[model samples]
Target: MQVRDATATKSVRQGWTGRTRVALVVALVALLTASMPASGVYADQSGGDNNSGQNALNAQQRAVLYNIARDTWKFYSADVDPNTHLPLDNIGPNGKRGTYTSAANVGVYLWAVVAAHDLGLISREGARAEIAFTLIEVAKLARDHGFLHQWYDTTSGHVIRNPGDIDCATETTPTFDNCYFISNVDNGWYASGLIVVRSAMPELRGLVNTLLNPMDFGLFYDSRPQTACNVNPAVTGNQPTGQMFGGYYVGLPVEQGSNWQHYYHNGALYSDPRISAYIGMGLHQMPGDVWWRSWRTLPPKQCPTDPDFSWQGQWPVGGYWQVYKDPQSGKRFNVWEGHYTYPGSDLTFIPTFAGGMFEALMANLVVPETTWGTKSFGLADRRAAQVQVKYTTEQLKYPVWGMSPSSTPDDTGGYGGYGVEGLRFPYFGSGADASHPNLGLSQCHGCATEDVVTPHASFIALDVLPQRAYTNIQALRRLYPDLYRPDGGFYDAVNPTTGGVGHRDLVLDQSMIMAALDNALNQRKLQRHFAADPASAAAHRYLSFEKLSIADTGNGDNSGGDSTGNNNG
Candidate 1:
């Protein structure tokens, strides 16, 4: 299928003049460091709470993760299309490759290959060959402003129209030429992987840069701050929007300032799409204030007509409105310092789109948010992990912990979103109300259910909850041995009630397992590789320096964040 790119591809450096690039850098630094107080400051000191947390894996834990990585790599080793080098989205019980792949699937596969080599599962030469083939085909695939379309035919590497996609073609009929939309989060993951591949295999740098450099992250950036907080049209007037959009339609007029869908602002800071903002800032495609634009929870505003008060999140919302100023334009933003609390507890944390483990931790696989924002994101990351553990094992009385989106655990083939229902916001497409306390096990109403305990969630938690993550994996094997597939790695999802498993291997899920192991086993090798990118340097301060208002509500204490360290044994 022939497709024209929205923007002509350029070299890694793009054609921006040196002066223009320097001005972007100046603007980014100003946003990160030059914030002046309007009413009260955001308590923006530096570092994260529990920054020193996360203990090293022990001998037994290392053996466990090593074996898991070795087994998980087998899925990619066999499931990839040899002619195209692109991985199929999944392999079902029939042991046949699935039809489609996404920017997220390919994105994680890039790092999976690097992780295999880093873990000694594959040689450097083998890893480079695999990555090179993938990039060569990717360069041939159609893209929007250097960003690949969301879905592509896995076998042929052509953009396909999927009706089931969250964002798909505007055309009613098949128009493979330029059918699909470009998703900010999907492309962010893809770009993040290229960043890792570029660093891990230096020999593949030129080919990788050919694909990575030209894709400007700024294309998806919605730089304007929103006029209101919650879903209130009247109060907000809904005009001045901010942050990144959910996605973009390459067919629609843009790159020329036609703001039709900029209103689809992904307001939450902890959502998966935050990766786009990170990459955009690093590339100087967006300003640093973009970080300040996303909501921890769209502050508990006076949207009285809306149900569940301002936001349909957990009750007794806790936070303050902290104002920040733009140094260049002198514009002020009333950033919400708000957060959600676990019912009957003071465990305060920022919520994700659906309270899924991957949503909270997927970006953590590459970006060192935990280390960079120890007081801010770092503290919230650790608390979120611990909350999942406590909620599942202690409250729900499940033998194993770790809740995330995965395939339905039933024998019939299916897929759906699963997460800690209490850990999300109903206002943000999550069925996260206190009334229903279902873990990722049984299907619930309203919230996108098919809630099954995905092992990948525990795997992703290796960075934050070192001890619990390791022990939980052991318990999973002990309680539900069928979940582990020694030959093809662990299956995707499991039913904690029954010994049922999803009996499938997904590229994205398996890749998360590989990446977490890569960092956990190799002393954060994947994160370090991505950190070396020039974009990472540009956004380091934004990640590192911040003091969030997420505090313990049990005793009404406001120590800023939980400083218990990285829950290591």
Candidate 2:
């Protein structure tokens, strides 16, 4: 990871530009109109089509969404150690425990719950109970030191490892007994969680306050450790050990010069500003102090490299490319590294975090009124034109959703057969050559892809379910209108070779995409009926297309031919 000055580029701070905004709005309207059905309008039918009708509809829709969420909660929340409320790691395949208990995961879940409640998906009571349960569990681990551990073994009701340890069992004890051992990513999730929780439980203002206070030990920013520092007498006091490669010594008193001897993995050490920004803006609803300061300071101090200067391209800031220059190599790396798709369903925090940031900004009160458009395709419309652009671009560039390419094996004998076309995209499905439709199925012995159809279906389903873009819903119908099966259930997986549907199990991702889509559709309704904006109407109109032409036909199935027609519907 490299550190660079925030002043490096003006565009970084202002991510959404005027040109991009206009383009997005236009594209979204066009895409939506092309995909949705014309017969059904998203207007409120109750109370003579006035604001009151819209409100009633919004309330009704919220109730329905809440019920749906409640049904799905059972799958995530189960019998954990009552004390820890963390699911046992051994409960699932490969002994993976409590998959959804991390701060980031929980934060997203909390946001979803909050969104559902606000949209009227769950009862107030239901929302409160869920929040209470989560807070209670989090409180159980609120140690005197203030920071939470990386995770708690739900089955054992104990902290399992220090935060960010490569191996959980390697270092059992804390190196520095500080409460804020957590990183920016975890803090972002925590801050977002607090924001939603406080929104619902206003009475918990003090609790929220406690959680927000950075110095009170409630939350601490996990700093990079000086790995080379060790408790060695050779480098202690005045003894000059010739063996001191970097002349660094660990465990030296903070007052001594040795405090600066610790070697960070990367040559640079700086506190992450993004985390601070989220907490300041999202939790406190105020400007961030640390982030602002970091912004002013841009890059931080640089240190000498050691053998331990390892960069694990997994974390959001660490992995992604920014303006920051690599200290070891002056060359610039694109931020899109480590983003290659694989077959398995391994979860990463970057996409979710980025998506959450976008969602939060859209939902925030600070959003400029200029951004809000009265026309269905205007700026104020949540279902703006850019959405279509994003969807289309992502679909074309990435193709598959959810599944990773690495999960598939090579052409030679490996767990899963390799050289499959769709592997690069994040979709999981039965392995078969599209060119050779009669071939037998291929499987990855060690890494089996999750149900394939979930990703595609969920992706499409989410686009239409949300109310922000009635046009999007309409466009979806027009482009891929015939997604629903004859049995009323939508196809989850489709074997392109045989055109078979519903041959896989539905997972949490499927539910999430569906829920998000539903919420987006309901939002569109609110904007149209309650907000009474023309942009909302246009969005609906925009989506009501009769047919969508597939521009790019690369399916990664090694198929040479490209098919485009009304078959999608």
Candidate 3:
């Protein structure tokens, strides 16, 4: 596998200079301190009676989102390789492939296809053809063991070889390499897509099962090749006991092989346990203990009470709290809250958004984190969604809302922060406004904060804050027409600083937008489909320890589980 030059890798972060960095800092302070208007501005535009604002706005947003998803289908069908039918990982303003494709893109494409078909955004026949074409392409890609490579050539369906700095590649010192490193999270996303597709069209069961079943996840967990770091440190009496926990390594390089050293985030691995645990549990790919034991040493949950910001409301972010142990001593010494790829010591006070708005909802869109056993994870989901909504209304002092870890139109990537009252982490990246002059170099599309507005985050929070989510969607369409595609869906994100929609259309972003919108409009159709599966059902059963009793179920309000039960299960 060939590795691209450092220049190619540095292209994403090419523009930010020290002057712009200072300007960005000033811009953030101004926006945060500036008074914001109320949420009623958009609600008042619903045309319907005040009481009907929510419903009317929802309907209006749904219509636009549906079209947007429909327009996005062309990228997978017409704009892709005619032979493979795999959409490019990115599309430029000129409608050309900006980069190679990847398993992550395919996974999202599959989800979008299902949503489009299920929601009647595309004809059934059209969807079946697209689905079949995509599956054939997936079958053709080179695989690490049985998993697809992180990135693929747009036309040949061959591996892209090097995907640069993204987590999909094997993280190596000096440089990251694509080298057919198998991505555990990418596989999970791909598998979830397969599950969703199978749920919709049972006819493809054999195909789905064949593609889904292979590949031993244990390979990623137990295999730790020798490096400067000790191999089997426990046996050498050099590593701590409980410090050796099992989880999937981020990826496996073709040459270096599958090992802890090749894992992403400097071999620390993703702390969002749900990526592998829940997916593996649902698919019966691994033992339930493999999933549950990861939390063997979690510290007790405590909601911080910070009056300046609503920290108390942001608990149990199920994904928060990485338990860092001294690899040699094996003593659990620290627990840091937030969705982080590295351990607790790596970040927290850097002023960076440790967890983007997207992290809060990406996995939840499918697994129903709202019902997960970790009470705080579920509570955080709702609170994060609510805070993000309010952030748009009251903090950003703009009409737009929702930020996540995404590339700004200028191609810089970072996490978004809600400029909430006292919670303003000055160095935190990714903020935007709907109105006002927050658009200067401080709000530069490509600033250090990776500041950009992503509607995908809003759509993901549909269940938690549908009204606010829908309101933002409408605002994006009505006020920021550049981000709105004629097909009714939105571009991957907007350079809110420049008020321009990005030229590139992202597959994963589209898939998320479609899935969230479909779930919002059709009574959570995608979630219900995913939950109905035995593997997902089994996983959820293990997770929902505080499920409601028969009395709670009888309350009509208790859909199925006990809503009032302790959420911190």
Candidate 4:
């Protein structure tokens, strides 16, 4: 399937008004100040106490987010040609058609819809209708060969490509991989879209099945072991062998190979905690829960450490190790621990995937007890039980937060080093107070660590659950609001070192941010029942977007002006 940019008939630039301009300036200034090199404040300082005087500001923020979601919905919905079931580009001034169907863009649009609904920014019915219509169109676009092309002409559901064109106007290869490499990001999006469809529309269960079932795609591997680069080179080289060994259980051999085929990294493999976190979450929504079980069953292994004490694997080594070891091995594999060649010793932080997977598992912890009827396998059962207890306890503790040390090669402060003596607590003792300017709220050592603020880190923080994840969410929301446009779009980077917002744009960043916000809001709602005091209640309400407003101004005057507008430009 061909992928093409949606045509821009009219300039969204004209939609910006003076008020938006002002808001943009103010917001940008605030963002810039927050990220200023001297400003070393961590965003979420209070662990679980949300009773700060920031309720009003929090409410305003929620309103802004809701408005952003609303604007996104209107933009996409308006572009969609109801009759053809295909989405067009932005509407031009004088009512002209701008561009054609964009598969990737539409996928993002659908996710925004899902996120809005989850955040309570849109009514359930509204979300359902939008998703239903979009899914139907998407289903129609799927070729008989099971590959979904990147773009289609909105006027006619036929696929379209860029101008340069190989065999222009004629059908080209109909493979998803052909459009993009077989990377986890692409697979994650495709998987996530399917999961959303399954969750929202039960009747469309077949679509989920279609995505899960592997076909005769040339890249398909039937049973392969996977490994990250930090593992023994012998183990890394035996990835194919491991996959072959585990072929019976894992079905297809998923390799961790990438263009950068080195012992330190894997391009094809997703090492970022954020992506893995979402993948784990999406896996929970699948039928029979094979992916979730596999994830839980996969033995963790130790490898050389990296700067952040975390490592993203390059190959499918964990699965292979598990197959060889046997299901009943009951061994705890430390996947993050890798033996690197040089300058790779600090990779001992908790498994990056742990936070994300833990978050997903927590979200679904309340799956009806009936769903667990008489399941076998002691480890699996035990893991579920542990997750249940942890999730239950966490929900009882609303606005949860975690306290961990940042990675700094110092005597008292470092990635794993608990600050001198009793300073390990949330508000790291008096020394933290004296050294860090933002009080405990902004000056935690962990925030400065590499893993805590990378795209992977942001992904993990946004996707995972537990108090720690929410704390990160709250921190980002407060500290880097500028990175997120008031219109539900987000710039790609948020500098962890300086807490500054980066100037890159990617549909993934916006989509992921929305997803994280949606998850946080949902968690807040779930934990509300356990609130014991007025403070907790306020905290829950504060994090919630339910009371937010989504009405549009006369022009595209989002209160924070077009910070995200110039992003695409």
Local distance difference test, each candidate: 0.67, 0.29, 0.49, 0.32
Candidate 3, 474-537: lDDT as tens digits? 7777777777665434667776656866655667776787777666656666766676655575
lDDT of 2 by residue, 1-569 (tens): 12211111111113654345334434533443354333222233111221122222255644543443343333333323344434322122233333223444444455444544555545454455444445556656543333344455444434444333343344554453222234334445455555545544443434443544442211222122222221123333322111111111123322355553442111111111233333333232322222211211111112232111111111111122233332323433222211211123211111211111122122221111112312211221122112222333244332322221111111121121111222223222222123322111111112333222122222322222223222232333333334332221232333222333332212223233333533343443222221221112321222221111111121111112211111110
lDDT rank, highest first?
1, 3, 4, 2
Candidate 2 wrongly placed segments (more than 4 Å): 1-71, 77-83, 86-100, 112-123, 142-145, 162-181, 204-276, 281-569
Per-candidate TM-scores read 0.79, 0.40, 0.64, 0.42
Best by TM-score: 1
**Model with the higher lDDT, candidate 1 or 2:** 1
Which candidate model has the greater lDDT, 1 or 4? 1
* Candidate 4 lowest-lDDT run of ten: 339-348
Compared with the true structure, the alpha-carbon lDDT of candidate 4 equals 0.32
- Candidate 3 local Cα displacement, residue 271, angstroms: 6.6
Window of ten residues with lowest summed lDDT in model 2 = 263-272
Off by over 4 Å in 1: 1-54, 163-178, 224-240, 254-263, 302-309, 325-332, 423-445, 552-569
Residue 97, candidate 3: Cα error in Å is 1.4
Residue 181, candidate 4: how far off, in angstroms?
6.7
Pitting candidate 1 against candidate 2, the one with the higher TM-score is: 1
The lowest-lDDT stretch of 10 consecutive residues in candidate 1 is 3-12
